[model samples]
Target: MTQATMTQTKVDNGVNVQALIGAREALEATPAAAQFKWRATCQWVNGTHSRSTVNSFFGLGEEQERPRSFTVDADHPEVFAAEDNAPTPAEIALTGLASCLMGGVASVAQHRGIQLYSVRATVEGDMDLQGILGIDDEVRNGFGTIRVTFNVDADASQEEIRALVAQAQKRSAVFDCMTNPTNVVVDVA
Candidate 1:
């Protein structure tokens, strides 16, 4: 891929400059109503497999319907008595983290007037399945640790890019959600 020209600051590097400006303006105009809520529904398909659909999300002022349907599948491996058709839930979670961070990087870079040629992130989580299988009470059911590595190519110094990533992480909702405790309620109908 070609390197981004430093002189061509007017070009948007995959991020929508106009949309970002508009969103910032809207938020500044109404800080109290800037909260956004996203929703998705999931249904069981079979053993260790499920599908989620995202159709609408509420934000800014009202509920907005999606222009197209978005679907995701979650499934375990065949070794776990699953069809191995789709990615496991843990894998999907990692994907979500990576995607969110990438978005943050792009948005932050754009806002800072930096032109980026490429940005990539690799995320890995260490998990012990013994807890989920009830084979070991000492083991945790989720990831014990998660690691992320970012490779960014931009017309900026390494220190500047590092600062950009740090700022992005601070602004990423997914990163906050993963690091902070969230209350979850489960009920059977």
Candidate 2:
């Protein structure tokens, strides 16, 4: 849904003082908040140990040196959940839009040499079941349109920011794709 209707995804809302204290006690075993990284181990399709052609990885959170391991292929470019179940490619498309915007905006800022601190983006798109479910042949299917509401948290003037966005549009290929469709040639390989 768009921001007009976007609400927070539900997370644990429970609050228990004793539980909190116990959790704090458990955390006390650690050095401090500013001194940790998390890691995760991931295993992808096929195998590992130099015999696997699998394209998966692992990572750790801030407390660890790396993330959990997972597999990747044409199916998942961002890998998967450390638990072996991350988001699919489509979820990543949205990420692509945001990332494209971020890169574009940042490039514009940097090319212009603006000392901006942070850039944030809110991306939204809608898809009908017919498109993804392959029920309707008439529907365009994949994201009729994706709207990006950029909330650039930088100390720049509105005029400069607007100019930056304009520059970003001038440079962002994905933005061009959405604004301008890319022609394709179909062939059976």
lDDT of 1 by residue, 12-48 (tens): 7678868878988989999866888889999999888
Q: Model 1 — TM-score against the truth?
A: 0.90
Model 1 residue pairs with clashes: none
- Specify the poorest-scoring 10-residue window by lDDT in model 1: 1-10
TM-score for every candidate vs. truth?
A: 0.90, 0.53
Show where candidate 1 strays beyond 4 Å. 1-8
Where in model 2 is the C-alpha error above 4 Å? 1-84, 186-188
Clashes (N, CA, C under 3 Å) per candidate:
0, 37
Task: Give the C-alpha lDDT of model 2.
Answer: 0.56
Which candidate number would show the highest lDDT if scored against the true structure? 1
Write down the lDDT that model 1 would get.
0.86
TM-score of 2: 0.53
